[model samples]
Target chain A: MDNIAGHKSSLTWAVHISVALLVLLWLLPTLGLLVSSFRTADQIAGSGWWAAPFPQEESLQLRTAGPDEMTQDGDLYVIEGNLLEQNGAGDLDISAWGTSARDVSAYAPGKTAEMRGGETMTLEEDGTYRLTSAEAFEGRGERVFVSATVPPEFTLDNYERILFSDDSREGMAKAFFNTLTVTIPATIIPILIAAFAAYALAWMDFPGRALLVAAVVALLVVPLQLALIPLLRLHLSIGIGKGYMGVWLAHTAFGMPLAVYLLRNYMVGLPKDIIENAKVDGATDFQIFTRIVLPLSFPALASFAIFQFLWTWNDLLVALVFLIDASGQTTVMTRQIVELLGTRGGNWEILATAAFVSISVPLVVFFAMQRYLVRGLLAGSVK
Target chain B: MNPALQGVIIVVLAVAVCVGYFWSSNQILDRVIFPAKGEKAGQNINRANMVRPWLFLFPALLVLGVYLAYPVVETLRLSLTQRVGSGYEFVGFDNYVQMWNEPKFREALLNNMLWLVVVPAASTAFGLLAAQLTDRIGWGAVAKSLIFMPMAISFVGAAVIWKLVYDARPLGQDQIGILNAIYLGLGGDAPQTWLTIPFWNNFFLMAVLVWIQTGFAMVILSAALRGIPEETVEAAIVDGAGPLRVFFQIKVPQIMGTILVVWTTITVIVLKIFDIVYAMTNGQFETQVLANYMYDKLFRANDWGVGSAGAMVIMLLVTPILVWNVYNARKEMR
Candidate 1:
């Protein structure tokens, strides 16, 4: 209100710098993971993601083509080949060369290292190597150690392997589809059920409405841990064991409290005149709800839909208890990522890519509909 | 049938069932049971109107009761008994006694207390700072969105992101984790295994939550800050209050209720803090929280009695908040 007196340029600069620092602090972990997801496994293992944009100096153990591919030149048994291609890293530059790991990188490119038997070997900066021996070549090619500078490299190969590869254990394609299956119905069913309940609680005068509303509010915080065994037992006894239908039902129940609470709060705030006018026009309560109230409650509905969608998509506990069984046929992305974390703990490439794949959809939804999401959050919390 | 195709069919069938139930029930209420054009049209209409709310409420309450309400009681019962061969044997207080003696349970309880105290305070403090700083600047929205972006990520995904951040490499190798990178850059001798350190690793896991929750606290508190009346702030400034003074002495007291709301909301979430701990450390290295501890007992150890007892501990912890919420709700209704 009065920036005239208190606003200092230094303080403003401090605020700016502080905010930037905080923002970077908050964003760095995710940025690191996102950057790592696109990097090759070797690159990730060799350097941090901060150093990803620069050439990474790595000591690679490479070999030339075996003696079978060698051709004699000038009565010399010769093996000429690109060491990088032979080692499966074709896009790196040989910075230095050596014949032994102890003195790896001792010889510069275009330099020759003397052999014990009056033979010689020279490595070019472009990874071309020539090995000249006086006698016939042996069964195996010479082992060479090359200090190569791998340029900044990024690839969709990580995503491709995680998302589209045929390796059943590594692929996330099934889990992605399974998450969508669990999320859509779970999101849609609850909103529909909650809308009708919300309308009744908001507008219609029924006995025990206040108590019912209080119950919903109280249920909002009940930890789903309580529901796991009992509900699973219920589902099992009712012949709806660990499966899709069971998960959908469990998610719906778990999400109902917030749905009814949020929608009721929003519905209660609507202009009273329009609803009264609609009712006075000889329209039934159903007509009024379907026409006037439902349309008017669009923001609240959208808000809860996003909430429920995000909740169900990211949920693991409910799905673990009610959906997944020993068969492991239907695993959602979050659960799948956890399993990957256990089995593939050291494989950052797979972990990061799988996580980003799981995180991407919600991030898109979050940014696209943040206005509604924020509105829902405020309404849900403020009341 | 293809699972994707099955999903599509289930979605379609679910929507159809819900819509059909609503339409047919309402139609039955109006046309068959209580015809509004009959001789006692007004009485018939009153009867139908009385029943219509239940018609709307039936499915919700039924589902909530079966799926939420009854489970609480059942879980309570399950905690009081042990499962025999094919049936359950009632063994009152034995499970709780078992849980009390288990060192892991005590460890989980203590860690949860630590989490409960630290996460909300840190998140709310940082959120208040962020809200205050970002409220006036030009690029504040951008800054806010970046801070808030973590809210969208799944706990498992965040676990991965942070796991990478806290990743430790050998001293000679390049440190992939930025934390270790920064540590080594700052003249530290060797890289620290951030998550493997016993007592401090709890803070490391809690850092992920505080990171995610700080944005939420910021958004809510920012709104509350905006809703602070301009006149009070102007009067405070006119009376010679500085920026920090005005924020604390004037704006803060007014918005304490919203702050508490955000605090308790985060508290509720922290009480059930399983996913991050489960995904990151799996309660290893003395970082066990109650929810994850419960999951371990129930799922891994195959002991539902002790698991239900653990769940009851969570419920008992939340009972006060639940009662307070219901009371406030009733008061608001009145």
Candidate 2:
């Protein structure tokens, strides 16, 4: 008995440790991007995001105040200031300093380096500096290379540039609104259409109802890839062309199968006695559907709404074919991010910030109403 | 006009129109067309009930027919015909012959097969593992939520997130990309540009999907696992089965049906995957999947014949699942 109990306790510990490891592995990639979005471009280039919270030692090249700032003191020309303080490193602790890039930390902080022209320079760990020349300093300020330990810094500048800047190439503000334009109508219209249809399929005794239900089931797995060219041709010929109306219609059509299927399934499960009672009360089919059936199917309605909203918001292929024009005026967030990936592939800061802005809205919806989303998935898939 | 303003106007107008249609149509039917008054009131009520379902079903059926059902037939016809000057000519399998001859098409076919196998399997395994393990611990809901969070992110958004992980820098500078950082830390001689590597880059792209989908599988599978009857597990324990034995031998067998359902659903998703590959590699470096390849042929190459042919190929791959789902649904209905 003791042996069995001992083994059980050990297995419990194993489960905890394994779950922790799995969660971390799953989260690390997204966490990296989330952390990277807040970091400066230089910090991202200098180290990994895992090392973001702690102070990091970095090498910086700074020029002293130009020769115009040099002063005459007791037959020596001198420049006095803090090298780190001058360069936004006021809080940094300098470990070493050098004049050449090859060996950035040749001398300890607070030590003086003898110059070629009978000049000497001293930099202290506290970031203060002194440059003494027997002759007057000339030309640009002397270049000082210093290795300093910098405190962890986070910035919202990347978000500012990506979201607010009017620069056409990097901005996502336009695309964000475009996505909203596509998603809202695309989501609401379908539920309205599908709810009525679903009510009929569930309650109304009509011929070929079984066939129609099967058709919806079959359409559920039909890849929307098949719809692209034909729909585009139809849209162009019908004068809707490639714009918001075309995309909205296409989404509504494509989303109809799932919307109808989920809602019908949920509505079918409603108590049959209520509809019979309503019928006995002389309420017509339309009245029962509008009054009782619609309200009772709220959970199903909410689930399908969340699904359609997320799918439309995240979609790229449909928009690519039906919405965006050559003018690029109707570009959505997903399309904009893809464009950024091609144009600014190496700029992690812009990419991260842009991706996050696009992802944040759906994330909010997902977290706030996760129950409905999960319920929808279960009904949509498990059946 | 501002698109946002246009959106608001459209929403209000759309809601008003829908409400008006349902309300007015129902009113007209009950009051005028088939008034529930006079000597023939019973007959009129029966007639209105008979016609009302069709009225409710009209818009949905019209949209479905034009948008989805017609597209399948039209795309198939377009595949067989060549676009010549402003019109189409029936070329009879020429597009398929040409697509078969193209090496890029073959590469895409092979890569899609690989994606179909790897993504669903990996996602299901990870999801099941997460589902089982998380179910056993305290604070599991938080862990499940974090894992499930990626499903909310769009494919393009996920592409950017993974691109940051797979980022490459020169050897001497500090490596910011997590993958390269780990590779170098483990004594790799130089940082590898993961997405540029030819054959293996496909796996790198598939990782994005697996990351996004595992949460979905975990959510569904976790529910299935919880739904398992506790007495069966207790029975296995009383029989002296170990934890691993109980999991594989007892619990998994019961949930096999749910697992298969999860698998096929993901398989359907995998077959139509586009945004991830389009954003990450754009079918470059032999990473072409069928959907992206079709996009390339249709938009970039301007050859609608081959593009529609490629679309048909996707449809063909999906047909078996569609049939199976319809069959299962019909069976359950019966």
Which regions in candidate 1 have their CA more than 4 angstroms from the true location?
A73-75, A81-93, A101-103, A114-119
Compute fnat per model: 0.77, 0.84
Tell me the tens digit of each residue's lDDT in model 1 across A71-158: 8898798888888878787777788888887898889999988987877999999888898899877777788888887788999999
- Interface residue Cα RMSD of candidate 1 after superposition: 0.9
As a whole number from 0 to 100, the lDDT of residue A14 in candidate 2 is 83
The DockQ of each candidate is: 0.82, 0.75
TM-score of each: 0.97, 0.96
lDDT of 1 at B32: 95
TM-score of the second chain of model 2 compared to its true counterpart: 0.98
Candidate 2 lDDT by residue in tens digits, A1-383: 21443476777888888888988988999899999999998788878999999888887888888787889899998999887777776777889989987888999987999978898999998888899998877888989888888788999999999999999789999898899999999999999999999998999987899999999999999999999988898889889999999998999999999999999999999999999999999787878987999999999999999999999999999999999999999999999999999998888899999999999999999999999999998988875
Q: Give candidate 1's error at residue B228 in angstroms.
A: 0.3
